[model samples]
Target: MKLNLNKKYANHTFHIDSYDSTSIQLHNLASLTLLLELTPRAEQLRRIIIDKVPPTFRATLPKLIGTKGKPILRRLNIVQQRAVLKAIAANEFFLIKGMPGTGIVL
Candidate 1:
Protein backbone atom coordinates (compact mmCIF):
# COMPACT_ATOMS: atom_id res chain seq x y z
CA MET A 1 0.00 0.00 0.00
CA LYS A 2 1.11 3.52 -0.77
CA LEU A 3 1.20 6.15 2.00
CA ASN A 4 2.24 9.78 2.16
CA LEU A 5 2.92 12.15 5.08
CA ASN A 6 3.45 15.89 5.10
CA LYS A 7 5.90 17.04 7.75
CA LYS A 8 4.13 20.01 9.26
CA TYR A 9 6.81 20.20 11.95
CA ALA A 10 9.31 21.28 9.35
CA ASN A 11 9.20 24.94 8.42
CA HIS A 12 8.46 23.98 4.83
CA THR A 13 5.72 21.68 3.56
CA PHE A 14 7.85 18.55 3.56
CA HIS A 15 6.25 15.53 1.96
CA ILE A 16 7.24 11.96 1.18
CA ASP A 17 5.52 8.99 -0.46
CA SER A 18 6.71 5.45 -0.59
CA TYR A 19 5.81 1.84 -1.10
CA ASP A 20 9.39 1.04 -0.10
CA SER A 21 8.52 2.14 3.43
CA THR A 22 8.35 -1.39 4.75
CA SER A 23 11.49 -1.00 6.81
CA ILE A 24 11.33 -0.54 10.58
CA GLN A 25 12.41 3.06 10.08
CA LEU A 26 9.37 3.86 7.99
CA HIS A 27 7.02 1.93 10.23
CA ASN A 28 8.34 3.66 13.32
CA LEU A 29 8.35 7.04 11.62
CA ALA A 30 4.85 6.56 10.36
CA SER A 31 3.83 5.45 13.84
CA LEU A 32 5.41 8.59 15.19
CA THR A 33 4.12 10.95 12.52
CA LEU A 34 0.48 9.86 12.32
CA LEU A 35 -0.87 12.91 14.14
CA LEU A 36 1.39 15.63 12.78
CA GLU A 37 1.29 14.97 9.05
CA LEU A 38 -1.52 15.64 6.66
CA THR A 39 -1.63 11.94 5.94
CA PRO A 40 -3.77 12.23 2.81
CA ARG A 41 -4.12 8.49 2.77
CA ALA A 42 -5.92 8.40 6.16
CA GLU A 43 -9.41 7.49 4.93
CA GLN A 44 -7.84 4.74 2.90
CA LEU A 45 -6.14 3.36 6.01
CA ARG A 46 -9.29 3.59 8.16
CA ARG A 47 -10.88 0.88 6.05
CA ILE A 48 -8.18 -1.52 7.25
CA ILE A 49 -7.72 -0.51 10.89
CA ILE A 50 -9.41 1.76 13.35
CA ASP A 51 -6.92 4.15 14.98
CA LYS A 52 -4.47 2.75 12.47
CA VAL A 53 -2.79 6.08 12.73
CA PRO A 54 -1.32 6.92 16.12
CA PRO A 55 -1.98 10.29 17.69
CA THR A 56 1.70 11.02 18.37
CA PHE A 57 2.40 12.03 14.77
CA ARG A 58 -0.45 14.34 13.86
CA ALA A 59 0.55 17.83 12.88
CA THR A 60 -1.05 20.58 14.88
CA LEU A 61 -4.26 21.02 12.93
CA PRO A 62 -4.14 24.48 11.43
CA LYS A 63 -6.50 26.95 13.04
CA LEU A 64 -8.74 26.29 10.07
CA ILE A 65 -9.05 22.62 11.06
CA GLY A 66 -9.39 23.30 14.84
CA THR A 67 -6.74 22.74 17.51
CA LYS A 68 -4.25 20.50 15.78
CA GLY A 69 -4.65 16.78 16.36
CA LYS A 70 -7.84 17.42 18.33
CA PRO A 71 -9.87 18.06 15.17
CA ILE A 72 -9.33 15.23 12.71
CA LEU A 73 -8.58 12.74 15.46
CA ARG A 74 -10.82 9.75 15.24
CA ARG A 75 -13.58 10.40 17.74
CA LEU A 76 -12.64 7.63 20.12
CA ASN A 77 -14.69 7.50 23.30
CA ILE A 78 -13.03 7.03 26.73
CA VAL A 79 -13.61 3.30 26.80
CA GLN A 80 -12.06 2.85 23.37
CA GLN A 81 -9.04 4.92 24.33
CA ARG A 82 -8.48 2.84 27.44
CA ALA A 83 -8.75 -0.37 25.47
CA VAL A 84 -6.29 0.87 22.87
CA LEU A 85 -3.88 1.96 25.59
CA LYS A 86 -4.14 -1.45 27.21
CA ALA A 87 -3.43 -3.13 23.89
CA ILE A 88 -0.44 -0.92 23.29
CA ALA A 89 0.88 -1.72 26.75
CA ALA A 90 0.48 -5.40 26.09
CA ASN A 91 2.30 -5.08 22.80
CA GLU A 92 5.13 -3.30 24.53
CA PHE A 93 5.46 -6.19 26.94
CA PHE A 94 5.43 -8.68 24.11
CA LEU A 95 8.17 -6.82 22.27
CA ILE A 96 10.28 -6.45 25.35
CA LYS A 97 9.83 -10.07 26.37
CA GLY A 98 11.10 -11.26 22.99
CA MET A 99 10.30 -14.93 22.41
CA PRO A 100 7.81 -16.05 25.01
CA GLY A 101 8.90 -18.91 27.18
CA THR A 102 7.18 -21.57 29.26
CA GLY A 103 7.55 -19.17 32.18
CA ILE A 104 4.75 -17.14 30.67
CA VAL A 105 1.91 -17.42 33.16
CA LEU A 106 -0.80 -16.90 30.58
Candidate 2:
Protein backbone atom coordinates (compact mmCIF):
# COMPACT_ATOMS: atom_id res chain seq x y z
CA MET A 1 0.00 0.00 0.00
CA LYS A 2 1.15 3.50 -0.84
CA LEU A 3 0.43 6.42 1.47
CA ASN A 4 0.97 10.12 0.93
CA LEU A 5 1.30 12.40 3.93
CA ASN A 6 1.76 16.12 4.33
CA LYS A 7 3.44 17.37 7.49
CA LYS A 8 0.93 19.56 9.28
CA TYR A 9 3.59 21.46 11.23
CA ALA A 10 6.33 21.62 8.59
CA ASN A 11 6.58 22.40 4.92
CA HIS A 12 7.27 18.90 3.72
CA THR A 13 5.45 16.15 1.91
CA PHE A 14 6.37 12.58 1.15
CA HIS A 15 5.02 9.21 0.18
CA ILE A 16 5.53 5.94 2.05
CA ASP A 17 5.19 2.52 0.54
CA SER A 18 3.87 -0.41 2.56
CA TYR A 19 3.59 -3.70 0.87
CA ASP A 20 0.15 -5.20 0.56
CA SER A 21 -0.65 -8.03 2.91
CA THR A 22 -3.31 -10.65 3.05
CA SER A 23 -4.69 -9.56 6.40
CA ILE A 24 -6.04 -6.15 7.39
CA GLN A 25 -4.07 -6.38 10.64
CA LEU A 26 -0.84 -6.61 8.70
CA HIS A 27 -1.74 -3.56 6.65
CA ASN A 28 -2.55 -1.60 9.78
CA LEU A 29 0.75 -2.64 11.31
CA ALA A 30 2.59 -1.47 8.22
CA SER A 31 0.90 1.92 8.34
CA LEU A 32 1.70 2.25 12.04
CA THR A 33 5.32 1.36 11.38
CA LEU A 34 5.49 4.04 8.75
CA LEU A 35 4.05 6.57 11.16
CA LEU A 36 6.60 5.66 13.86
CA GLU A 37 9.41 6.04 11.35
CA LEU A 38 8.18 9.47 10.29
CA THR A 39 7.49 11.01 13.69
CA PRO A 40 10.29 12.16 16.01
CA ARG A 41 8.06 11.64 19.02
CA ALA A 42 8.39 7.93 18.35
CA GLU A 43 12.10 8.21 18.94
CA GLN A 44 11.48 10.02 22.19
CA LEU A 45 9.16 7.25 23.28
CA ARG A 46 11.81 4.71 22.43
CA ARG A 47 14.43 6.49 24.48
CA ILE A 48 12.06 6.78 27.39
CA ILE A 49 11.56 3.06 27.25
CA ILE A 50 15.08 1.91 26.48
CA ASP A 51 17.34 4.50 28.09
CA LYS A 52 15.12 5.52 31.01
CA VAL A 53 15.51 9.17 30.19
CA PRO A 54 12.90 11.87 30.34
CA PRO A 55 11.46 12.78 26.96
CA THR A 56 11.99 16.27 25.67
CA PHE A 57 8.53 17.65 25.14
CA ARG A 58 7.54 20.38 22.76
CA ALA A 59 4.22 21.49 21.42
CA THR A 60 3.26 23.91 18.64
CA LEU A 61 -0.33 24.93 18.14
CA PRO A 62 -1.00 28.01 16.07
CA LYS A 63 -4.45 28.50 17.52
CA LEU A 64 -3.23 28.07 21.08
CA ILE A 65 0.05 29.91 20.86
CA GLY A 66 1.13 32.67 18.54
CA THR A 67 4.07 32.65 16.16
CA LYS A 68 7.45 34.34 16.76
CA GLY A 69 6.39 37.93 16.27
CA LYS A 70 2.62 37.94 15.80
CA PRO A 71 0.26 37.97 18.77
CA ILE A 72 -2.64 35.62 19.19
CA LEU A 73 -6.20 36.89 19.50
CA ARG A 74 -7.00 34.29 22.11
CA ARG A 75 -4.98 32.04 24.38
CA LEU A 76 -5.54 28.69 25.94
CA ASN A 77 -7.65 28.63 29.07
CA ILE A 78 -5.67 29.46 32.18
CA VAL A 79 -6.31 26.10 33.85
CA GLN A 80 -5.27 24.04 30.84
CA GLN A 81 -2.28 26.23 30.17
CA ARG A 82 -1.13 25.95 33.74
CA ALA A 83 -1.50 22.20 33.67
CA VAL A 84 0.58 21.91 30.55
CA LEU A 85 3.30 24.11 31.98
CA LYS A 86 3.39 22.11 35.16
CA ALA A 87 3.66 18.85 33.26
CA ILE A 88 6.53 20.11 31.18
CA ALA A 89 8.35 21.48 34.18
CA ALA A 90 7.98 18.16 35.95
CA ASN A 91 8.97 16.18 32.89
CA GLU A 92 5.72 14.29 33.06
CA PHE A 93 3.75 12.80 30.22
CA PHE A 94 0.18 13.97 30.17
CA LEU A 95 -2.76 12.92 28.10
CA ILE A 96 -5.42 15.51 27.46
CA LYS A 97 -8.76 14.00 26.60
CA GLY A 98 -12.00 15.68 25.72
CA MET A 99 -15.08 15.12 23.64
CA PRO A 100 -15.33 16.42 20.11
CA GLY A 101 -15.66 20.18 19.52
CA THR A 102 -14.29 21.02 22.95
CA GLY A 103 -11.52 22.97 21.20
CA ILE A 104 -8.94 20.82 23.01
CA VAL A 105 -6.01 19.85 20.77
CA LEU A 106 -3.41 17.31 21.89
- Top candidate on TM-score is 2
Worst 10 residues of 1 by lDDT: 91-100
Model 2 scores a TM of 0.28
- Across 2-103, the per-residue lDDT of candidate 2 in tens digits comes to 554444536765457534555876877875675567478767666666577754455644433334323322355665555445455444465456753253
lDDT of 1 by residue, 1-106 (tens): 8443445444666346545447866887776576345665555355335554443323232364334534333576654443433434442122122242222222
Which pairs in model 1 have colliding backbones?
33-57, 34-57, 35-57, 35-58, 35-59, 36-57, 36-58, 36-59, 60-68, 61-68
Q: What TM-score do all the candidates reach, one by one?
A: 0.19, 0.28
Clashes of each: 10, 0
